[model samples]
Each structure stands twice: as C-alpha cells, then as structure tokens.
Target: MSEEIRETQQQPQEQTPPPAQETFKPRPPGQRVTMKELLEAGVHFGHQKERWNPKMKKFIFTERNGIHIIDLQQTLQYFEKAYDYIADLVANGGKVLFVCTKKQGQDIVKEEAERCGMFYVNKRWLGGTLTNFQTIRKSVFKLKMLKKMEEEGVFDQLPKKEAVKLRRKKEKLEKYIGGIENMNRLPDALFIVDIVREENAVREARKAGIPIVALVDTNADPDLVDIPIPANDDAIRAIRLLTSRIADAVLEGKMRREAVKLAEGEEADFIPEEE
Candidate 1:
C-alpha cells in the first residue's frame, strides 16, 4: 500500500486546459455605438467567400466557415466619415435623394426620407429619372392633374370606363413617380441602401455628377460610390441602423440650416430699410 501510494503521488495529475482563449473581445462602448451593438446587429456578417468582390478585400477582416467577416472597426470609421459628409452637405443647402428600392429597404427608406424631409425612391427606378428630368417632370404634372380631377369630382361625372382608365393611369404614375414629385432638380448627393440592386440609380446619379454615399456589402464593389459604409446590406436591422443614422445627420443639418436662416432674418430685420 505504501509503494502504491508513492507511485500515485509521483504520477503527474491531469492538467485542466486553460479557459479557451476568447475569440471576440468587445471594445468599450462608443459614443454613437459600440462594437457589441454592431456584433449583435450582425453588421460583421458578409457574403460567402465565393461571392465576394476582390475590390472589397481591404474591408474584409477574415473568413470563417467559408463566410467573409466584415471589419466592424472600418465600418465605424467610414460610417462616421459618411455621416459628417452628409451633415455638412445638407447644412450648406445641398439636397440628398434617398434611393432604396429593394423590398427589405423600401419602407425603411421611405420612412427615413420622409422623417428628414428629403426626396426618396422606394419603388422602381425609372430609366433616366435623373438624366431626363424634363420628361419625369411631365409625368409628375400628369399625376397632379389626375389628382386635381379626382378632387374636383371630374372622375365622378365621367363614364365608368373613362373613370376607371384615368384611375388606373393615376395609380401607375403614383406607384412610380410619386416619391420624386417634389424633386425639382437633380439632388446634390444620393444616399443609397444597396448599390448592386440600385445600379441604375447609381449610374444615373454618377452621370448627373451627384455624389453618392452608400452601404456596401462584401458582394458589391465599394469603389462605385464616393462614400461607402461597409456593412451587412441585406439585414433589415442593419439597414434600419444605417439609414436612421443618415436620416439623423440630415435632420441635424436641417436644424443648422434653419438656425442660419433665422440668424440672417434677424440681422436683416435689425437693419433699417431706406427711408
């Protein structure tokens, strides 16, 4: 028994492995947002490795299980940069058109744009909507005419067939150009949700010399836009977060613009008109 005890004591005891090294360490909370929030929102998720754009290599942090992981640090940096740019543009009396026609983003884009009092396109992107402004304006005028007729009871007096035809035309126009009816001219900039999906809008905006700020996924080319905020463009929550941030910037800018206008008005009021 003593020999057995000595042997047991001499044998090395099984060593428990140190706690598995933590793969993800959340940074301290940030002012606008924290890395943890972004993680929870799945902003770090990217397209499959096979579908990634090579031009977006720098934005990618790594690959896990054949999926590319976006670098949230870069997302934070670029998002801030885009936010500042948009705010300054609006404050300086520049207009921004919100373009997001994807089903996942349509309602969100429309709501945010309306919240910020900016123009938006939540439906189909008509070819030459920007390039052919005169034609689009005509369509908008037609829509207004149709609405006026309806309000004035002209549709009520018309034969059923005629009224039905006119109503269908009005609905079609409203479905397509209703959002941009108030857009008198080309916007100074564009805030796009998915560049790949809204390629025509991007192309038209580029041709019209309008600067673009867009949320780019790994599958899309980031170089297409002037300011690209790398993020998960498909996730509804991610889209809401990004669009809301941009809308906030627009609202802040509008406030600044109003302040400037009020200051100008006060200064003018204080000045005496020629007696």
Candidate 2:
C-alpha cells in the first residue's frame, strides 16, 4: 500500500458527542452530635435553670421571639438539620447574612463566616441593608467620591498648612462610614446568631424574600426561622462547633462544584471517535 493511503487509514474518524454528566448531591454540613455530648451538655447546664424540670429529663435548646434556651436533645437534631440546609443553600450559589447582637456570639459567628469565605454583619445590622440596597450603594459612592477628590489634587488646592488637617478629616470620615462595598447586593439567605436581638435585620431579610437559618434558643420563637438550629447560645464551645460545622459544609459544597466541573472536562476529552 502507498504511504499516503497507510497514513490516511491511521487517522482517527469523527468524534461522537460525550454522554451527559451525572449530577452529584453534595454532602450535608454540620457535625453529628453524639448522644454522649448531648447528655454531657444537659448535665452541665440543664440543671442550672430553676424552670428546668428534672422529671422531663429531656432538655433541648429552644427559641421563640428571639429568646433562647438550651434544655433538650431535640435541639441537637434541630441544629443538625439547620446546618445541612444552610450548607445546601451556600453550595448552590446562595449568599448568607450573619447577624448577632451579642459581642461573643458575633465574634464566634464572624470567625466561622470568614473560614467559609462568606459575608457577615457582626456589628449592628443597618436598617434597609437588604430592602434598600441602593441607599447603601450611595454611601459607598460617597466614599469613592472622597477618594477621587483626594487623588485629583482637590485637597492639594487647600493652603499647605490646612491640607494636612483636611486630609485627616477625610480619613476620619471614611473610617466611620461603614462597609458598603458589596452593599448593593442583598444576601440570598440570613444566618442569625441571636434572632430576637436582631429582629429588625431579620424582618428586613424576610421582606426581601431571603430564607433564614438561625440559632434558636428556648426563649426565641422557632417560627421566625426557615431553618432553626436549636443549641446553647451562651456556651462558646457549642456555638463554635455548630458554626464550624456549617462552614465545613459550605467548603464541601464548593469542592463538589469544582469536582463536577472537572468530571465534565474529562468526559469531553474521552468522547469516542465515530467510524
């Protein structure tokens, strides 16, 4: 056979379309609370409350109208469920607003949020943060204006001695103006540490059609939250563990997304050649 014919025969034929990739369900977030941990928590704090009845022997965390309490095992299950729901939301491209009135709770929640690369409102939840995103954008715009003025030599036009003082004033104003960089965009969901204390923020989130995932103690109403995690709001250990579980879930969801992309790429590469 001629060399040209041999080379032609060796060449691959037309490729067939790749098969549709299978969708993967991501793992749910939050660590499982073992029965031992639940019992220990009950023993440590369950008896402290005068209202706690020893006969009931089943104390779970409860929340209603923003108040919180930890008394029952059912609360642990609630936390697990809430954590999974939040994880699913985050994995599916939803944003979350983290709100907490207490400094300790805010700090704990903020740390977990940062770990998961999500935004939070540890400070006071500004009114209309969700409802009136344009107003917040205007604030951010004002900051940008100040920065532009400084860069364009507007401050330099001032008397040499007064320029430094003017610059200091500008810096002070910018410092206290609050964060409005991403303010124009409202979160897809809200995760409140103390739903009662930050009720206004929660209400705004609700009005904007944002789903809420909140830590509900006995004192707060569970009805307020779309997904309520019943747990000890006062205990640092409990708070940290619960928040971390949610963060981990978000991370896992992100990983699953990346994995899906990779699988699609591999399948494209392996398409069979059509004769």
Candidate 3:
C-alpha cells in the first residue's frame, strides 16, 4: 500500500477541461432546401388520385396506392429557381405577401414571414384586397387611429359602452388584416402554401401583376402560379420546412442589401487621390 501511494504521488493528475459555449450558426440560406430535408418532411408525398389536379400530372413521378408521388428532382430544380427569385426580390427592397389561410398554414406562414420582416395574410382573404387596397387601408387606418386614441387616454374619457364597441371593432379588424396593417402597398410577389385554398389571393395577386411563388401539390393547378414548387402542401412538416427555406432566402437577401448599403456608405466617405 505504501509503495502504490508513492508511485501515484510521482504521476501527474489530469485536469477538467472547460465546458463548450454553444454558438448558434444559422444554415446558409437556401441550403435547407435539400433532397434529404424534403424527404424527411414528406415533401414528395402528394394528394390522392380522387383529389389530384389534372394540370399537375406533368409533375407527378408515379402512382402508388392511389396516391401521387411528386418528383423530388423536379421540386428541387424549381425550388432552387424560386429561392433565387425570392432572394433577388428581397435584396431589391421588394415585398412578398405570404398567403395561407388554412389552419395548418396560418401559424407557420405567419411566423416565418414575420421573422423575415415580410407581410402575410393568415386569415380570411377579403375580396378586392389587392384591387381595392384603398378600402382595406382605410380600415387599417381606422384601427390605428383607435389604438392611438386609446394610448392617449381618449378612450378613457368616452362612455363605457362606446369604449367597449370601439375595442371590439379593433379586435375584428385585427383578425382580418393585422398581419398586413403595415403594408403600405401591394407586394412585389406572393408566396402561397395552398394555391387552391387561397385561390382568391392568387387571382388578386395576378390582377396586380405581381409575381407568385407557390407550393403546388398534386391537387393544385400548377399553371396558376408563376413559380411552382411541386410538393405535398397538405403535410404540416412539408409546409413548415419549405416556408422556413423561403424565409431564410428572404433573410439572406436582407443581409445582402444591408451589406451593399454599408459598402456604398464606405465608398461615399472615401478620400480620393489628389492626383
């Protein structure tokens, strides 16, 4: 025992290393739109035969168990094209309107669009929203006025019943257009989750001559969209994944725009050669 203790005393003991600090490195923009991601999110699965849109027959790879299987290769190519278009659009200070009123689409689209500082419509698509933007803007203005009045104590001076009525009206308007209250004009492009479900929005966007990037499933008319990414629109996972990729592209565009502005500012402040 004494000899073992003496041997241990001659050896150096190991020391504990410091814990790693977690650093979050974001995915490089459209890099998320990969075949692995698409497959993991069930993006290749399409609608059943009974619900399939004949217009989308060209994008279908095969028929299995009465369900259509989307061609991932086609989806990848089209998605890349769409991503580049969206990136360029945002880098030029263009706006994109995300339209997805269905329950599955509402939350994901709203979250992603807001994260990228883009506008969206997650609730009911009001008729003439694009054509009669003036009327909608009026409603949004009224909402803002009421909110400002409340903040300035104007509502406190009113009758209790009148205050309640105004508050209720504001809530109603918020449900319809809160996501787009800050939108001063029509968007440069429209990104839709379910093209068929939000057909009115698509038609309005087309009427405004705005570009459209849409998730065209087997049950959706692919020709209706300007840029169609053929995928499974019904799957929540797929929608979430694709929307995230779109949002990332927007984010990258915004970053590029800021970089360009900074570079321009630097050039403007530079001292030229006297010669």
Candidate 4:
C-alpha cells in the first residue's frame, strides 16, 4: 500500500494555473520621462546585424542574437537636440512637416501632429511635394477651387459622368495633399519616422535644402539626416513615445509664438505723441 501511494504521489502533477493579471500603471502627466521608460518601450532594440548601417556604428552599443542594440544615452542626447531645434523653429514662425507613412505609425502620426496643429504625411508621399512645389501647389489650388464650386452648387449643373470624374480627381488629390493644403510654402524642417521607409521624403527635403530630424533604426543611414535619434522605428509603442515627445515640444513652441505675438500686438497698440 505504501509503495502504491508513493507511485501515485510521484505521478506528473497537473499544470499549474496561469499567473494573475497585473494592473496597468500609468505614467503621470508633466513628469519628466526617463531613459528607463524608453527601454520599457523597446526603443533600444535594433535591426539584425546584416541590415545594420555602417554610418550608425558609433550609435550601436552592443548586439544580441544577431541584432544591434542602440545606445540609450546617445538616443536621449540626440533627441534633446532635435527637440530644442524644433522648438526654436516653431517659435520663430517656421513650420514642420511630419512624414510617417508606415502602417503602424500612420494613425499615431496623424493624431499627434494634428493635436499640435502641425502638418503630416500619413498616406502616400506624393513625389515632388517639396522639390517641385509649383506643380503641386497648382493641383492643391485646383482642389480648393473645386471644393468651393461644389459648395456653390456648380457641380450640380455638370453632366453626370463629367461630375463623377471631377469628384474622383478631387478625392485623389485630397488623398495626397489634404494634410498640407494649408501650407502655402515649403516646410522649414521635416520630422521623419523610419528614414529608410520614407527615403523619398528625405531625398526631396535634401533637394530643397531642408533640414531633417529622423528616428533612425539600425538598418537606416543616420548620416543622411541632420538629427538622428537612434531607436526602434518599427515598434508602434516606441514610435508613439517619441512622437508624443515631439508633439509636446511643438505645442510648447506654438505657445511661445502666441506669447510673442501678443507682446508685439501690445507694443504696436501704444501710440507715440509728437516729440
């Protein structure tokens, strides 16, 4: 009986129940986010060894499982530099064009950018948007005119097929330039996510002599950008964390701009008597 009891007790135990779920802890507002938070978002993770860009060798701190790891110190430093530059640009009446067309980043980019009243390209990047501005401006103008005409009941007078074609053309243009329609001139700077994926935007900005601030992964050429923040550009969480920082910086810049304008208005309001 004792031997049989020992055999039964030694039999494989049933699988243990899974661990209990943990509550989500939210980061506090206005708190200075730390490098540790950045790590939690996987910003230090990089691409495979084979895809590592030689120009980013200095930014790579180490490697694991054939993947290059970004130096968090360098990322923090570079990001601060970009943040300062963007703030100064916006405070001085400059505009920033955000380019993040990747699937994971599109919705995030649009929301963050719009929140700060900045422009973005979340859809297809229309070539020549910056380099050949005149032609693109013409199309944007036509689009606006068509919208006005529609509002005035002009489209109602057109033939059925002709109006349908016109509407389709307007939709296509909007898909390309709707976000940038309010921008009457080339952007003073461009903020790009995944420089490798949005290389066309990079090239166009370069062609137009515009400076670029980019979140560069290991697979991307960091030297191509004016300011490169080494990070995991593919992860949505990492992208969101960084872009949220940028959006905050932009909002701060806009606030400064408003303050300056208000001061100027007060100064202009004063009347000087004849001396």
Candidate 5:
C-alpha cells in the first residue's frame, strides 16, 4: 500500500480508547442543609400555631423578614437527608417503620407504607413492642383467638336477642385495633412524623437501638432523632412532600434490584449450553 494509504488505514484502526471511569466522591454529612434555609423553614411552618413556649420562640425567632424562623427550613433539610439515607438502606433490602403521633398520621403513613411495601406503626406504639417482641406476639395470638372464635360459630351461639349487639361491639373493638394485630416485631428504622407528640414511641425505639428518622417542628428537640428533618409537621402539604420523597427513595431501591435481576438474566442467556 502507498504510504498515505497505509497511514489512513492505521488512523482508522487506532482504538478510540474506552471512556475514563468516573470517580464518585462521598458527600459530607449535613452538606445538604444550611442555617439560613432552616430558619426560613421554621417561619413558614410556625404561622398557624397560636402559642409558643420560650424555647420554641427562641428557636423560631421572627426578624425583619416578617417572620424568619428555622423550624421549617430545618425540617425540610432533615427530610432531604433522611430520604437519602433511607434510599441507601432500601437499596440494601432494608425496611422502615413509619410512625405518627397525630390521629390521622397513622392512616397517612399506612397508605404510604402500603404503596412502598414497607412497615408502619400506625397503631399506638404498644409497650414492649420491640424490647419484648414475644409479648407483642401474644397480642397477635389473641387476634388469632378472635378469628378462631368467629370460625367456630361462637358469636352465633350467644343469646339470640343479644347476638347482634355483641357482634357490633366486637366489630367496634376490631376497628379500633386495626393495625395492632400486625405488630409482631420491631422495625429496623423508625420514621416519626410528629416527634413531640410521639415522644414515648421515640423513647422506646431509642431503648431498642432502632435508628430514628423524625420530622422535628420548632417545639420538638432535634437531639431525639438519629436523623431529624425540620419542617412543618402539621401541614399536609409538607408532610406529603416529605413522605413522598422517602417513598420515592424506597421505590428507586426496588427498581435497582429489578435492574440487577434483569442484567443477570441477560448474562445467563449469553452462557453457552452443553453441545
């Protein structure tokens, strides 16, 4: 081949080397949050409360910016960080416990948990639910007893005139104790929606060594949680936003697992079968 032609062939054959592998640096803790943003967050969530104690007032101080506060900002930042942590856990086949102190918080959390296939402490955090797990198991056993009684026609055997009333009362108790029957074990991680309101649950979880992720309002002490997100605890918008973020993290983890499975399947397909 001519020199020019040989040079052209060599140029075409020269490998465009594989792209450089990207290196990922670890993110610093609390790097996602700042003091000013936390202060503003507190102000946004503080407007509805009628009264504030001295500590809360100090934490949620109002400046010339109308009502500068840190609670809302801190809560939001906390959620962001907590969600990031949760995503890592879920990616590793971990579970989360969603607990709320407010009445409706249970239902809200339950809905989210079901959507994400995670656990929740929607019912009252029964004493010894974690420390004495078998004791809580006994409660589940009682639910089995109720089921057995129903199956054996025990309710029908009651006095005919009183049977309906008795059945109604039983149903009421069952309704009140909706999610309690499922609480046979402690959660790996606990997410408390209202830290101030659910302080007892927090204490119990702490004693059991379960990691805690909580939404801390201005009135709540941040030290109670392993991961605290300062935000408007009472506002549905804020709660939904934060909870959804956590749920999204869990879903992302699930997707990652599925992708790995698919990749494995493709690899298997490429393997040669015996001749």
Candidate 6:
C-alpha cells in the first residue's frame, strides 16, 4: 500500500483533522483529556513495525503498512489509572521526579515539572540519582552553598582566579543538579518519558523501590513501568499532551492536599460557644 493510502486508512473519519500549525495549550488541572484530543496530538502513531518489541503487543492496535498504531483507547484507559495514582500519591505528601533526557522532550519535561512543582532531570540522568540519593544530596547541598555564597557576595570579594573557578563549578552543578537542588529526599515515584532511552533511570527507580509512570512506545517494554501509558513517545505534540496531563494531575493533587490541610486547621481553630 502507498504511504498516503496507509495514512488515510489508519485515521478515523470522525476524528478532527489536525490544524495547519498545531500549538499546545494545556488544559486546567483536573480537566479530563479525550480520545479525540489524543488523536489530534498524533498519540496513536507508533514506531515502525520492524522496530517493535514483542512485549508491547497488547498495546498495539494494528499494523498499517510498516508502522504500528497504538491503541489510544487503551492509552486513555491506562492514562486514567496512572493519573489517579499520581494524584493520590501527591495528595498524601508524596513527591515525584520527572526524567526525560531526550532532546525532543528535555524542554517539555522541565516546563511540566516546574508547572507541577516537582523535581526533574532533563539534561541528563545521573547514575544512582535515586538509589544513591545520599550522595546526590551532597551535590545538591554544594550547589545550594555556591548559590548562597554568590548571594552573600563572597565570590565578588574573592581573587579573580578563585572566583572564576568557583563560577565554573557552580555552572556545572547547575546543569547537572539545578532542577533537584531542593529535592532533599528521594522521590516517591518517577515520571519518565521514554523507557528505552532512559533505561538507567528505570533501573535506578526499580532499585530504589520507587514506582514509575511512563510513556511507553511500541519499541519499549510496558512491563518495566508501574503505570505505563502507551503512546507515541517520539512525537513532540504527543509528549507535550501527555506530560501536560500528568502535570495537571499533580497540580490537582496539590490542591486537594492544601484543602485537607485547611479543613484540619479550621477544625482545630473552632471553639465551642459558652454552654
């Protein structure tokens, strides 16, 4: 079959055609995403069939020509479960770490993590970041110290050569651990973009007993993650949509947590009238 013919046959007639230029606008926290939105974001498109992993067979809807089509219905179903789990986790004072080292997803990962007020590793995933967290905490402390020194004007008073050296050191730390400077403890869970590309992160999370919620493509094993939402991991639009949804869930969870705190505080402050 011709490529154009395969594409047409794969898409549904009822689905809305993508815009001339697709721009992502994140939905509000607690808002639900629909299958039609997923379709428009191209979440159904998977890797080529030849690159498919046998373990991902259950998530594959079908093969059109040489490409695999992800089951967006399954994606939506699993995504709901993942969303609930993440929201519940955060609601109970749990923390999540976002890890997406791929060039296509680095900026999106950083933005989403910040939007949800979670720690992230977009530039690179350092070994043992989770399993060996004590060591990572030391680096985080050092980064904070450097930042404090700069804020205190210590660097300005130092010798020029010493100041230059410290500045270089601070820049390196900022690149590696800047996103995690405030992450004093290991995260309760991990949100990974591509499991295959970030295998080290998956391994470290497993070793550290942290749950993982990840976007699993056709070429990756869904079983590696605790909650795997199967989708097109290579597409920027798909990544943006999925990550934004996850961030919204986290934001919702934070709101719920604050509400609970407020209720408890109000109850504690309530005093019975004179009887």
Stretches of candidate 6 off by over 4 Å are 1-31, 271-275
Residue pairs with colliding backbones in model 1 are none
Predicted structure 6: lDDT: 0.87
lDDT of 2 by residue, 93-171 (tens): 7766666657556666766676666776766666777888887677667677777778999878988778787677667
Q: Rank the candidates by lDDT, best first.
A: 6, 1, 3, 4, 5, 2
Q: Report the lDDT tens digits of candidate 3 across residue range 1-275.
A: 00011111244459743321112123553464778999988898987788888998889999898888999999998998888899899899999989899887788898898878899899899998898999999999998998898899988899999999998988888888998999999889999998899999989888889899999999998888899999988777888889988887787778778789999999988968789
By TM-score, highest first, what's the ranking? Answer: 3, 6, 1, 4, 5, 2
Each candidate: RMSD: 16.9, 17.2, 13.0, 13.4, 17.4, 8.4
Q: Give the Å shift of residue 176 in candidate 2.
A: 8.1
- The number of clashing residue pairs in model 6 is 0
CA lDDT of each prediction against the hidden true structure: 0.85, 0.61, 0.85, 0.84, 0.63, 0.87
Give one digit per residue, the lDDT tens place, for model 1 in 1-275: 00011111254469853321222121222445557777877788888999999999999999998989999999999988888888889999988899999887888898788777889999999999999989999999999999999999999999999999999999999988888889988899999988999999999988998899999999999988999999988887788878977887787677778789999999999998798
Per-residue CA lDDT of candidate 4, range 1-275, in tens? Answer: 00011112354468753321111122333333469878987899998899888988999999998889999989988888888888789999889999999888887788788777788899989999999999889989999998888889887899999888888888888877888988899999999999999999999999899999999999999889999999999887788889978776677677778789999999988968679
Estimated TM-score for each candidate: 0.86, 0.67, 0.87, 0.84, 0.67, 0.87
lDDT of 5 by residue, 157-245 (tens): 98877867656655654543444456445667887887878878888889999998877666677777898765656655455556655
| Residue runs of model 5 more than 4 Å from their true location after superposition | 1-43, 47-68, 71-76, 148-177, 180-184, 265-275
Off by over 4 Å in 2: 1-31, 35-72, 142-180, 271-275
What candidate 3 gets wrong by more than 4 Å, as runs, is 1-30, 271-275
Cα lDDT over the full model 4? 0.84
| Model 4 pairs in collision | none
Evaluate residue 230 in candidate 3 and report its C-alpha lDDT on the 0 to 100 scale.
97
Give the poorly placed runs of model 4, Cα more than 4 Å off.
Answer: 1-33, 267-272
Whose TM-score is higher: candidate 1's or candidate 4's? 1
Q: Per-residue lDDT for 111-230 in model 6, tens only?
A: 899878899999988987888888989998888899899999999999999999999999999998988988988899999999999999999888888999999999999889999999
Please provide the root mean square deviation of candidate 5 (C-alpha atoms, Å).
Answer: 17.4
